[model samples]
Target chain A: MVPLYWYLWLGSVVFAVGIFGFLTRRNIIIMFLSIELMLNGVNISLVALSHYMQDLRGQILVFFVIAVAAAEAAIGLAIIIAMFRNKATLHADEIAEMKG
Target chain B: MVEWFFGYLAGAVILLSILVVLSRNPVHSVLWMLLMFLHVAGLYLLLNAEFLAATQVIVYAGAILVLFLFVVMLLNLKEELRIKRFTGGWPFRLLIAAGILIILKKVLDGFKVGFKGPWSIEAIEQATHTKALGKVLFTEYILPFEIASLILLVAIIGAVFLAKKRLRT
Candidate 1:
């Protein structure tokens, strides 16, 4: 059997990549995708811990996390659309009109 | 054998995720993200979370990705393509990346492993993942489940309100 630490290590690597992408990428959409990646990393660890502990709660929490992620994507994309309409730009740096 | 399979799946997930971040075209990023989600769902299946795997595919790969693509297309694609894909300040990004690595190292160093609970492998196999999940989710987590529904409803309303085109006065 694969040890639990391997999964946790994988999760941490993926989460680090997500953070890197989120901080470095200029496109707002890519940044949002990075956020999703970070969430997936968390989900992986949650499921791994669930399996390791032989508990159902972690998996249940994963379910809730997925639900919340969906909700977040919906609202976030809508907000992105609204921003695009107003600013006509996708670059995060250029969208700082309110940065007085 | 299963360990090798897990290794390959995990590696593919990390690779596709990097591609999702690095791809220049927004459309390509969305596609890469779709593949990454599928791989993640596969990992969930390996972990014996069958229902979560199915939901991951349906909700993330199917619905959320399509939504991303729609918004990608709706935006000014030509303009988006003309701009630089990455931001300036590599030193700062590198600093943050190093900080994250340090944090991960610290967390993993002290990580504990293996605590048995009610749902052992044999018990879960006998009861089946979906059934086992449903029992606990409906009973122990029913309140949070209902709250999740409320949150989804709010999200729907918020999306509609935010995306609707305003009328001229």
Candidate 2:
């Protein structure tokens, strides 16, 4: 078996990339995708810890995380669509108007 | 052999995640994200979380990615293709990411895995990952599970409300 640290390192790297994308990307959808990436990163670590600790709770937590992520994606996309309808753009900076 | 498999899976996941973030076109990013999701499921399998592996694929790749594609197509992003790809201060953001990575590395280095639960790999395999998870989820974690369902219900209503067309003169 691979050392647990390997999985931790991998998760951290992916999370860093997600943070980078979320901060640097201008598109709302891409930012959302980056958030998914970050969530997956945390999922990796959760499963890794589950394996290391011989526990099933970590996996159960991951299952719930996936459920929440789905809900978030649905509502987030709807908001994106609503924003696009009102402002006619998907760029985060351009969608900054208060009264829409 | 197991180590090699894990290395390949982890590398693929990292590479695909990078591609998902860096792809100029949102459609391409979605595709890369699909691949990344698969790799994450593979990692879950490696960790013996078969149920989560399957859920990851079915929920994320199957349902969520399709929704993303629908939104991408609905938006008609031809004008967006001509705009600048990234936000300003990207270099500083990259530096911040690096700093976060370093901090996480230090934290992980000092971390110790001390907990030894009743469920071992052999025990879980014998009971089956899905069965064990369902037993705990429906019994011990039932309240949170129900709350999760409620959250999803709220999300459904919110999505519909947000996307509904207004009736106007």
Candidate 3:
């Protein structure tokens, strides 16, 4: 049997990779996909814990998280499209209107 | 026996996620993400989450990544595809990611789980994971379910409104 901590470690590693992508990657779409990666990583840990602990709450939370992620993807991509329309660029560095 | 399988899935997940991050071409990144999502669903199946495994494939792979690919192709991002993969001082960002992982490890070392629930593996298997999940979702968590539907509703309207062409005002 695989130890549960291995799953936990995988979760954290995946999340960290997502963070690395989000921070370092300049492409807006990649940054957005990185957020999705982070969510998936967290879901991995939650499901592992829920399975080990014999709990349904974690799965429920994962369900809601997936739903919310779907919603977030719709809204986020729409915004990305709108931004690309206005700015004509996908580089996050160029769109510094929010920066001081 | 299972350890080897777990190792393969884990290694694939980690590697694909890294590739998703590092690939210069956005379409390649999306395809890599598709592979990573499948491996992750495999992990879910290993954990006795058949429903989530299915949902992961259907929702994430079928729906979400398709949205990403649609956007990637629709946007015609020819210029950004050829540029450097990261912004300036990317090494520092890598350090930051490593630091965060270290912190996560330290924090997880002290983690202790409490209070086991009644949904044992056998119980779930007897009732089936889907039935039990539906029972709890429709009964105890009905309110939140409604809220989630509302959230999706809002998302639908919002996405349409935001993406729709508007005349200059």
Candidate 4:
């Protein structure tokens, strides 16, 4: 059986990559994808822990996390669409001004 | 065999995740994210979370990445593609990434196993993962489930409203 630490390591690497993307990427959609990446990383660790601990609670927590991730993605994409409509640019830097 | 499976899945997940971050085109990044999600589902299956694996495939790879692709297509980013886009200061991003990695490693290194519950693999195999999940989610976690549904409703309304045409602005 694979130990929990390995899974935890996998999750953390994914999270770190996501953080890097979130920080360095100028494209807003990519930034959103990075956020999803981080969420998935957390989901991995949670599920692994739940399995190793022989508990259902952590899996249940992952259920809620997936739900929240879905909600976040839907709303985030909608916001991206709206911002694109208003500003005609997807560059986070250029869209810095609140004004259209 | 299980170790090999986990190793491959972990490798693919990490590689695709890095690709999603490093790819120049947003569309490519979305596609890479799709592949990464699939690998993550495989990892979930390795953890005996078949239901979660299925959900990961269906919801994350199927629904969310498609939505990402849709938005990327809607944007028509030809000009955006021409310029290789990145925020200022390479070192800051590297610092942030390294910092997060170190923090996660430290936290997991010090991690303690908490109280084990009744949901052992044999118990879950008898009851089945999905059924057991549903039972607990519907009974003990009913309140949070309802809240999740409400949150989805809000998200639906918010998405529709935000993406809607102004009509008479």
Q: Whose lDDT is greatest here?
A: 3
Per-residue C-alpha lDDT of model 3 across residues A1-100, encoded as one tens digit per residue: 7877889989999999999999999898899899999999999999999998998878898999999999999999999999899988988888889887
Candidate 1 lDDT over B23-126, as tens digits, reads 99989999999999999999988888888999999999999999999999888779778777777786699689769978887989898875689999999999
Clashes (candidate 2): 0
Docking class of 1: high
Clashing residue pairs for model 2: none
Candidate 4 lDDT, B50-90, residue by residue in tens: 99999999998899889889889988898888776677796
A24 Cα displacement, candidate 2 (Å): 0.3
Give the Cα error of residue A22 in candidate 2, in Å.
Answer: 0.5
TM-score of each: 0.96, 0.98, 0.97, 0.97
Candidate 2 residue-wise lDDT at B81: 86
lDDT (CA) for every model shown?
0.91, 0.92, 0.93, 0.91
Give per-residue CA lDDT, model 2, range B55-160, as digits (tens).
9889999999999999998888999889988887999999999999999999998999996998898998889888989988999899999999999999999999
Compute DockQ for each candidate against the true complex: 0.81, 0.89, 0.84, 0.86
Query: With candidate 2 superimposed using the best TM-score fit, by how many Å does residue A87's alpha carbon deviate from the native?
Result: 1.0
Q: Per-residue lDDT tens digits of candidate 2, residues A14-82?
A: 999999999999999999999999999999999999999998888889878988999999999999998
Docking quality category of candidate 3 according to DockQ thresholds: high
**Can you rank all candidates by DockQ, best first?**
2, 4, 3, 1
